[model samples]
Target: MPSGPNSGRVSRSSGRWRWSDATRETTDTPTAATLETERMKDRYGLEVSTSSAEARDAYVEGIDRMLSAEAGVEDCLAAAIAADPGFALPHAALARQHQLYVRPDEARASAEAAVELSHSATARERQHVEIVRLLVAGQVPQALDLIRQHVIDYPRDAFALAPACGVFGAIGFSGRIGREAELLEFLEPLATHYGDDWWFATVHAFALIETGRWDRGRQLAERALEQRPSTPHGAHTLVHALFEAGDDDEAVSFLEGWLPDSDRASVLHCHIWWHYALVLMAVSRHDDAWQAFRHNCLPGTTTSPPITVFSDSSSFMWRSELAGQPRDRAIWQQVREFYEERFPQPIVFVDAHAGLTYAVLGETEQLQACLTELQELGEAGRLPAGTTGATLGQAYGAFVDEKWSTVIDVLEPLIPQVVRIGGSRAQRDLMTNTLLAAYVRSGRTDEARAFCAQVVDRRPTRPVAGFELC
Candidate 1:
């Protein structure tokens, strides 16, 4: 057995290529030898440290389903643990699932279990478990360092590499300027290791689209969807690329066709519907957009994580109002209540949207309280997104008070740092649209047209109804 960092060994046995840990000893009996040769591997061809085939198979199914945002991921992962109580990877995966659903305590518990069980596993599995443990414990810097090293050693370990990949991933939320370019740089080198893989293509496409390489992103996204049509991530990435290219017609058509077959209980379901609503708003289908929001994106209706529910619902309503829809104070109050219930603390992304809700609803007390918290977090250097959200929140408050110049003064200088708040460029358009509306309403027509031209240089369309300057 080889004893080094590259400890995964491939050997031809029984007319098949099989992967095995280099540390595993060869068995004498033919049946035992064959069983060892045929040990269960995951969909990514990484060997899982589980003796039970049922456990291994269930773990693989659960991971695939989780990556694609399908329903039944938790049940599948739970079944894997039920089949083999000591399978470390399933526990690690369950921790990730719990984190995705915003169940932090359960995530930490499962992460601890994974770490405990991984002591007897391979070095790769042990590292995987440890990274997940760090992530669930909110030790993101350590987890990211470990993930970088782990991927270099075992690039096919997709789950281990997942924490740093997407917009909400560690890098996206790193509060670093130019993080979009950083994400593309991080993923581009790994392309060879993940050729034609649906998950890789989807995330890579997203990074590309976010960085303004929409044409290349669209090609990859299309291929990813063709490779796995059921993958909601692929579909979501494709729409983002389309949205960036200003192809609202095709974007809406594709989503309307694809959404019917998707599971509403899935992770990206509400978000995907939010994307649909955005495109509908772009095309002047305001009635349809409102219907879509009411059905899928409303607080009571959405089954998304708390962050998604709050950000998506609040942003959609605010954008609708900007598009000349009458303000529905009742709906804004419902969104405000949901935000208060789900997130009392100031997560930079959620707080950014919470500001809009509070401003629109005239909740001056709540708004001031949130602003104070954000200011303190920023002053202490505790805010991962720095003061971007706080500044934007203040801008929203100014906009609500009809202080257009104040909104311009606060928001224009902060535009460069807005990416730190961690959402898709499309999602952050809530802020951009706000600034544009401020410029227009303040009779700063020249500045509005210049800003609109800059936006058009990046994207082909500006969909805000009343603030169209081009």
Candidate 2:
């Protein structure tokens, strides 16, 4: 019965149970928690007086309630960050929202603003920039130190330790994140304090999937939906797990039956639907998968999105691989220019790493400079989030050289870690699949078969958003 605002349909083996049957109960039971999670008002008022610590806690709690429930409230929170110009929480909220929308610069700005506005922005938010910077610099040790320090300071805050997980995952911190207590500590208490916090449960579910505890992931994801709020993090994790677990029919049922209406949801949560598209493609439904990407980034086919979203490496990779056709090279040119606008260099990884795209485009000097910059940062520890990371560097190296096997070999082992750190499952899959197809084209099928099986096995089990088999 997972049919909340974000719930996909839930089905039972027995024909005896149906959604209509579940909805037959006349009046829906309205509760305070439900009300709290559904507060979509755009008004900004500090109703909770902050003279006392209790009032501050209440104020924070009220804001958290709205943010957790309503998507539009994100703009409100961002405005609040602007309005106060000093409160740390609004900045954190704005940063997180920016991150969700795949706007890394916005996220970085918000995180930095949070630290600038408050000296006590908590060790976590401060570490955000520090770790990202170190990752960009390619100084794994220095980056880990900053993240490890946060672990000691805010041992109970998942937000604090979560960055370490990302650092270790995407950038390769010369350590195993799954074995890191810093990450476990963050996740453990989150599952405890917010046992009811579906967002935290999403993280927990991902951890479970990583550990091969599929049953646990399934259970946690179900529990997450039971506590569904406005944001679809829980739904993203839940659907991903179901798909990964080979519950394709159930995943589809979940999406169509319980899925929320997607219009005006957010222009940037492409991960949400791209995930769904991956699952659908996995189940051999190319048509459905194509529609997912089209619905996501394709412009003004209305029920179609504005085309502005498609101009990126990530988006084009999707268009190339899953559109059940060859890539539109014209689109690639447009996307390349668009990516350039978003990632003008500052010695960042995405840009430096993206130099491979420049290399592919025959901009030899740009590629060489990007390579030189990337190596320097990786060795010295100067890059920031969305910039320096071992995986990005390694992938870029092989990518620039056109060494398909190296890309696969280097990236395969890094997948679980990067996803754990929230490096983005959709992005990683795009990179991996791109490598896989290229390998096949090079007549390296024997090498790629194992990897393709892994992709087929893994992508569905860890369901992405907006995808379902037709």
Candidate 3:
């Protein structure tokens, strides 16, 4: 179905976007510096803040505003930059906005400007935004510049160090691991300081979960939820914590209630859809899971390129598998090569999950490599999700290798770990279902029975994980 002029829009001008000539509610002569600020308040209704925590909030808020199609986020970012031209992020934000809109020159200029602006930022803050700017621009070399800087100057900035945790681990990246023990040293303090801030906590959660602090990550996520109960991210983190802690039943019940009342939309909608879909998939509702995927993809079908306009698309795509479907092959082929070659350094979740769609297309090698990298990340404490790339692959490997013990042994520990370390209870459904299959197939009826009992304890309302495994 084609969207008539306003499918995903919140505001429009006679069915066309009012891009430049914005409507303003104020009459003050716009300062050249704050010209964008006046336009921002007049058009989108956002406030300016210079504090670190507020910067994080503004980032999310600006992204939200852009999602609403109110005014381009660039409007508010302009205002932010006007208020404090020294702030690296406002310029970085504009660069990102330009990159998304496909203004290459502007994007490059903005990224360059971010570097120039960073001179005034604290070593930690400069290191933080530079990689992001490079990452956003797809300039991996420049991104790597900051990576080297992270290793050398002010190496303790949590944001800069977390991604560096797996730089060498990436199959395509360059480096030899010299004393891998250092990873823990770098991540511990970062995770400790990041306990309450949502984004910091999220990054730290991944760091913790990836490094094997499943219980700790869950606790931190709980702390994150306490900080901002209504923020979608907090809700997202809470779900992962519950699911990983082996509470799938509550996870499902919680999401089922939340989705109807979620009553809001943003770039993170895909996370919601995917999370819900995972719950439905656990309950063996394939149709509902598919619907969730479709909902996340709707904007992509209607739009193009960068699909950040829909939040859940990123998470949902990474979480859901698509081997049996015909359309999935088409989706895989269309973007697989581009993502594989084009992205300088892959966003692991995106690359790993996207690569899995090719499992049946004889791209098992690609999938295997992705899974290997993910396994390394999980083992080393970089990929907090503990998402076994081939949830089925582990069981199949155990079966074919006649190591039934491996299947039961491997999956038995993983179910709770997944729930505990992963971001939300909603996300852990995939783990529970995967473990249920692996346990039963490995011919460990005793453990499977225990799993059956354990799975139900999480959510008494969910039907027991029956003998059918998956």
lDDT of 3: 0.47
Question: Which of 1 and 3 is ahead in TM-score?
Answer: 1
**Model 2 Cα shift for residue 370 (angstroms):** 3.4
Query: Can you write out model 3's per-residue Cα lDDT over 108-192, one digit (the tens) per residue?
Result: 8887887787886665557667776766666554675576667555433333443344322211122212212244455555443
- List per-prediction Cα lDDT, in the order shown: 0.82, 0.48, 0.47
Weakest 10 consecutive residues, lDDT, candidate 1? 1-10
The best candidate by lDDT is 1
Show how many residue pairs clash in every candidate, following the order shown.
Answer: 0, 37, 24
Q: Where does candidate 3 stray beyond 4 Å?
A: 1-75, 82-87, 93-107, 118-185, 191-202, 210-215, 257-267, 297-470
Candidate 1 colliding pairs: none
Task: Quote the lDDT for 420 in model 3.
Answer: 27
**Taking the tens digit of each residue's C-alpha lDDT, what string does model 2 give over 250-317?**
77767665445643454324545665665666666767766776666433322211222432234444
Candidate number with the higher TM-score (1 or 2): 1
Q: How far is candidate 1 from the true structure (C-alpha RMSD, Å)?
A: 5.5
